[model samples]
Target: MFAVTVDQVGSRSDDDRVEQAIDVVSTTAAGRLVLPPERTAGDEFQFLLDDAGTLLDVVFALARSDGWSIGIGVGDVEEPVPDSTRAARGDAFVTARAAVDRAKDVPEHLALEVAPGRRLGTADVEPLVTQTVRARQRRSREGWELADLLRAGHSRTEAAELLGVTPQAVAKRWSAADLRSDDAVHAALARLLTEADTPAGADTPA
Candidate 1:
């Protein structure tokens, strides 16, 4: 299981965006969430999920916007799960809280934690995930525009037409944005996250 906690950064100075953020994440996380995201405290929200790929999607969606500190905790949740995230209990939630607090001070504003005595490989995986997210955060607006179009299933020619640019230009943007590298990173991160979540000596699905 994964528990994600997000806290609004600069909340005192910025306009309240909790609702908007929730909307974005909820959309990205639809059908995969164990508990629908909900505000847990002032300017903070939490959600539960089981799939690492969905967790990655949720993290990327949140990272697209500024002013958020994201933390993911991987571990077991107490059985007899509650319908509300706030009511959920276990090491996952505890570690998520700690992870979020640490995230506020991190360069990428993201962090990962594993319940003590579980998923010891998380130590190796977290840094790579953080670095990839940091690189993604540096992507330019033009890069994002092209990326969005391509991600929507538009071919380079189609995206170019939509953006009123040449296909060459679209290709240039894609290369400059390192979007190809993102694909590899995404696959690696998902696999790594799954491994990190798997307890030592436990059988992991191929």
Candidate 2:
């Protein structure tokens, strides 16, 4: 199981922003949630999941809209897991809180704690985000527009149709945007994490 905690940066300073972030997180996490995300404090939220596979995707999505910190803990949850974050009890929650505290100390916005060796804050998100930033920095205004359309699941042909351009033109912008490489990197990371989460001797997807 994976326990996760998040607190919006300076959310308490602006009550309205906290409310807005809560809505954003809710909307983004709807179908992906295991235990529904819950507000633990006015500015804090918590949830638990049965796997760590999708952690990166969720964190990056939240980071896009606003500033927030996240921590994830991989371990066992006590039997009969409750739907509420407050009602859940286990090493996972304890580790999650610790990781979040560490995240608060550093500039990075995310941390992960793994069990079996007490690997707290083992995953570093900086390199992944750095590559993304580099990719964004290399883009132009037109490139961003084309990239956004592609990111929304539109193919080069579809984006070209929407922009009234040739598919070749859209594909050129897509290459310049480097979103394919970024996505490939993310997909590789997700696979690695899933394999790590799977117990030894248990079969994992190839």
Candidate 3:
């Protein structure tokens, strides 16, 4: 089975609103669908399809006139092993993730075919890191960083006020940082804070 992930990008911060939008899109689309997306990122949906060509065509056709940008990824299992069903699901997830990245780079109304080689991780992380730094720099230049505002214990809306950006933007940043998921984000942040407090070069990647 091939995994087909369709991700729609829109401007919204409310998790409920985003989920509703995605639900509309998924219900209106085709194939055996699985849409267990992290909340607020609802514009994203993943599906397992036997035919890639048909799935891609239908998704593109359905999305073309919706005033929304949609990206798709087509992925197959990396290896043949036990739990074939689970493996296919993983492939579908990776494909959808690649599609999201492609959509971010291009303008709306453009349909991109996500070849495996062009998917994420194939590209160097330094450029992404640089872009993130530039965005952070711009935010810091405009006002206090989101980190500082959060560290100061300001409410989400209050942090937005301090940063001179919309409350949605603040929420997006927080969610994008994976803080919405209690266990994953807490563990990640704890490890990051620990590493930061440690001396540089004390722990190196293998």
Clashes of each: 0, 0, 0
Ten contiguous residues with the weakest lDDT in model 1: 116-125
Candidate 2 TM-score to native: 0.75
RMSD of 2: 3.8
Residue lDDT tens for model 2, 110-194? 6666555332224543355434534455578778788778778987788899999998888787787776676777777665555
Provide the global lDDT of candidate 3 against the true structure.
0.44
For residue 139, what is the lDDT in candidate 1?
A: 93
The clash tally of candidate 2 reads 0
- What tens-digit string does per-residue lDDT give for candidate 3 at 66-175? 43444444334445423332334444356555555665665443233323432223233223322332333344322435655664677788988877889888877776
Minimum summed lDDT over a 10-residue window in model 2 is located at 117-126
Which structure is stronger by lDDT: 2 or 3? 2
Q: Rank the candidates by lDDT, best first.
A: 1, 2, 3
Q: Cα RMSD (Å) per model?
A: 1.2, 3.8, 17.6
Cα error, candidate 1, residue 24 (Å): 0.9
Estimated TM-score for each candidate: 0.96, 0.75, 0.36
Instruction: Give the poorly placed runs of model 1, Cα more than 4 Å off.
Output: none
